[model samples]
Target: MVARSFFALCLAAVAAAHGDHDHDQDPIAGPLQALWYNTLPGDGGTQADSVFSGISTFGRLPYLPCLNHRGINYDIAFIGAPFDTGTSYRPGARFGPSGIRQGSRRLNLYGGYNVPLDTNPFNSWAKVIDCGDIPVTSYDNTFALHQIEEGHFSILSRAPKTDATKKGPSLLGKTLPRVITLGGDHTITLPLLRSINRAYGPVSVIHFDSHLDTWRPKVFGGSPSEVASVNHGTYFYHAAQEGLLRNDSNIHAGIRTTLSGPSDYENDGYCGFEIVEAREIDTIGTDGIIKRIRDRVGTSNPVYLSLDIDTLDPAFAPATGTPETGGWSTRELRTILRGLDGINLIAADIVEVAPAYDTNAEHTTMAAADSLYEIMSIMVKRGPLSVMDGEKEEDL
Candidate 1:
């Protein structure tokens, strides 16, 4: 009886202490309250907060597994193509992918630039992952391009396997994740187009560069014996010849370079491209340029946007193999990209970012990263993965 009374008293004492304890002062309770009440940090988290906070991928997202890994699916993948051997002037573009990734560290995933874009691209609009770099051989150009094509094929093949008999909208028929390539140089676009053509057929291109890139192949380095010698300048010519590009619909913007001859213009014209010279931006203005692009590409065509860093004037983006004296300013480029909200953006790349020429501030790389973010925003707004069942085709 005496021991039972003592135990009862002990229980009563424990209850009194529990009731008197300050929840705010309690370590476990305080953290729980903070979880509910604290403002979310913009840089993902503080350095000491989580190991993942410091890990680097584009936008600091988790690394994606290889496509062959069973049951894995991604809506978008950032793949690096780090080859510069095809460059005619400078060669440091091999470092472009790394430089762009490094520059992206300053960006916050939660807040995108305030534009007319409807939603934050990373806000569950699509599933995005970094697939890392496509391995490229430094010595063998032909073999390297083949490897890039094969790597891209592997990523596209990951789209969910569908019924061969089924038919519908091209966007709905797609099962593969869209890709954003960080380039070694502009030559990488040829292999990229080859991969995309296998699935979406010949796509319309939105080419932005200081040079018309459609110069005759032989002018750069091609010969009858070496017909395959495709440099950055001649890839689009080859792309058009191989039936990998929609001739009449494709357009080139920001061209400022002197052509090899009048025949270069004739060649680009024969390829079915309309040219918008860099100086034309001052005359036509941003809205006019946007209208021209939209009218040319239309809503149904699957479009690939290729941005060469030299499209920006050397004053704005100096870190390129071929810097032009007069080109679009960073603001002009960003605004133009912002205007392309509803077009069907299947795949895109930002190329020719040779970091070796950048200033101590890395301004060129930073501009490239911002341009990539803008493209991603456009993709989120128009990509098939983000469309609803009843969504209008124009909205997509």
Candidate 2:
């Protein structure tokens, strides 16, 4: 009886302490602020006191395991493909997605505004969210490729919650959401293109890289196994063969890599891409390059943009799978991307950013993040492709 009474007193004391202990009050929960704000942090907490703090998503966007979660739809979703076995040179590009997100922490700190485009892409009409990274297996390259394709297709097929009533674009009588993938390597584009082709048919490509990436497997020197052929160097060749690319409508910008021979250029042409050499930025200027790209791709067809970070000069972005000298400055590339504001950009990727090779200042990852920000702005400005337009049809 005495021990039972002591236990009862102890329990009462614990209850009293629990009842008396005060928890820290939420700053935004004050009466006036409460009227304007909800429990969910505005701008995904980018406006937090420190930029370096918090879970990192691109531009500090909201993170959702969108693939695993049903009914969580978005107009523009950011998904990471973190497989790098397809890389021929450097191996750390599997970390590209996290590196790019870390670099993008400051993108929306100032209300997510872009003075050049005169818009805040984050606050725009589209429902933008970070879909988190696709769980790609690193064990097998072939299985990883299929995993990426299935993961991307899962997100792309969902109907988005948009600010506008009209659906952006459709192919098989269903409206599709847009995807901005943080890449594993240039090889990731092949699977991405396959998934996009299912929804939009063959898409015109705006490929920005230091290499053509369209080399034939034999010419590029792959093994006897067919699976061995699909590396970063030759995914576009496979994309072309798979009928995923719109022939005669694709373009490659910032190419400056040395080839095996002149026949490599011939092969690139045969794969249906017009090249805007990196050296042309000096001779024809950014305006001329932009015009060439716009003229080649036009404005109505669905286009996929694959950006390899090596497209920037090593002086600017040294941390890539293959760093080539004498490429475009980040500013030059941004200007050209801004000039492409009205094109029908359906999906895009920023690839080959190997942060292990980056400087302490993180120039390569920053360049990749900023370039993706500009692309997002352009997409927001262009809105979505209207379903009724049809002038982009060309012979395949």
Candidate 3:
């Protein structure tokens, strides 16, 4: 009892000592004031949040529901399509959008600059924003595709941001805002191309993949339903049928997948795309590959670049829905993309990232994010496409 009473007395004495002096007065207050006064304005979190600190958007970009335009304008927008029902093998690419964004958290930190490009896209004239994921239905593939199309078209239809009003290479007279999609799967590209067709008519495509995605739907053993036929493997064929692609102008790179037969190559040609097989990367090299792509698509045509994560070797990007071995390294791919620097790359998508198969270090997701950073850098370097300073829209 005596010991307990002594303990109580000691606690009371400590409390009295702590409360005796006020933090708001004298020495304590002066130092606190100094610390507060010396602290920077954004130190509390506005201009410089920790890379891991907030809701993940691609590159930590501003989040906007671009589908609800409401007078909102942007030069570039990153839209997320989180539907992956079209996958033929693996199925978790539905989670790709969020996974890619998480991988991109470090992108805009450290001044958001690209030294080689000598520009910072985030700080440049482009008003870039992240339009959160399209609320696509998982139950119905056809309806989900419709939703994706509608969402994409809504963004494509928006007027460009004031500073980014440079004319595009499209048939449209006014400037068109560019959309860099974080894809659900390769199937999303069909709807994306449909939206692009509405804005720019049939544009040339620069397809990067380990598989010849231009396969005819019949090759997949004839689906019972029409919607079932239009999948990742066959969306490009549908795009061709819908007149969404420019004939003889499209090209496929990094193709190394097995085909039904030699007729598959003929079908790919019929779909209006020439192939640069994956094995050629050994003999022709990245520079040669880039030259072939540039030669096929030309420098002035508005190009829609669709990159499948599986284009990178499984050693580098194994987390994709349909990863194949003997594909390009991330470095080789990025270098080739850099080679297309001056070409009219209008819009792009990086798809087929199924994070369910990823490593704990997120190699596949990081590859996708870094590839986007390179693509975004390329876009920034080119600035917005224009129809020459004083040229009229119809003179071409």
- With candidate 2 superimposed using the best TM-score fit, by how many Å does residue 162's alpha carbon deviate from the native? 1.6
True-vs-predicted CA distance for residue 305, candidate 1, Å? 0.9
1 versus 3: better TM-score goes to:
3
- The digit string of per-residue lDDT tens for model 3 on 1-396 reads 999999999999998887885543332111223455557665442233467676889988889877776577888889999989998999999999999999998877665778766667777767889999889999999999999999988987777774346655556677777889998899999999999998889999999998888788888737768988999999999999999999999999999998889999999999999999888988989989999999999877788999999999999999999878999898998888878876777799999999999999999999999899888877766666564223223321
What candidate 3 gets wrong by more than 4 Å, as runs, is 1-47, 163-167, 387-396
Off by over 4 Å in 1: 1-53, 67-70, 113-115, 160-172, 222-228, 383-396
Question: Each candidate's lDDT (Cα)?
Answer: 0.79, 0.86, 0.85
Please write out the lDDT profile of model 1 over residues 150-236, one tens digit for every residue. 888787656532222333234346445678999989999999999988877888999999998887867766544442568798899
Cα TM-score per model: 0.82, 0.86, 0.85
lDDT of residue 241 for candidate 3? 95
lDDT for predicted candidate 1 compared with the true structure: 0.79
lDDT of 1 at 53: 44
Model 2, span 278-378: residue lDDT tens: 99989899999999999999987788999999999999999899889999999999999888877888889999999999999999999999999999987
Ranked by lDDT, top first: 2, 3, 1
Error in Å for residue 313 of model 3 = 0.5
lDDT of 3: 0.85
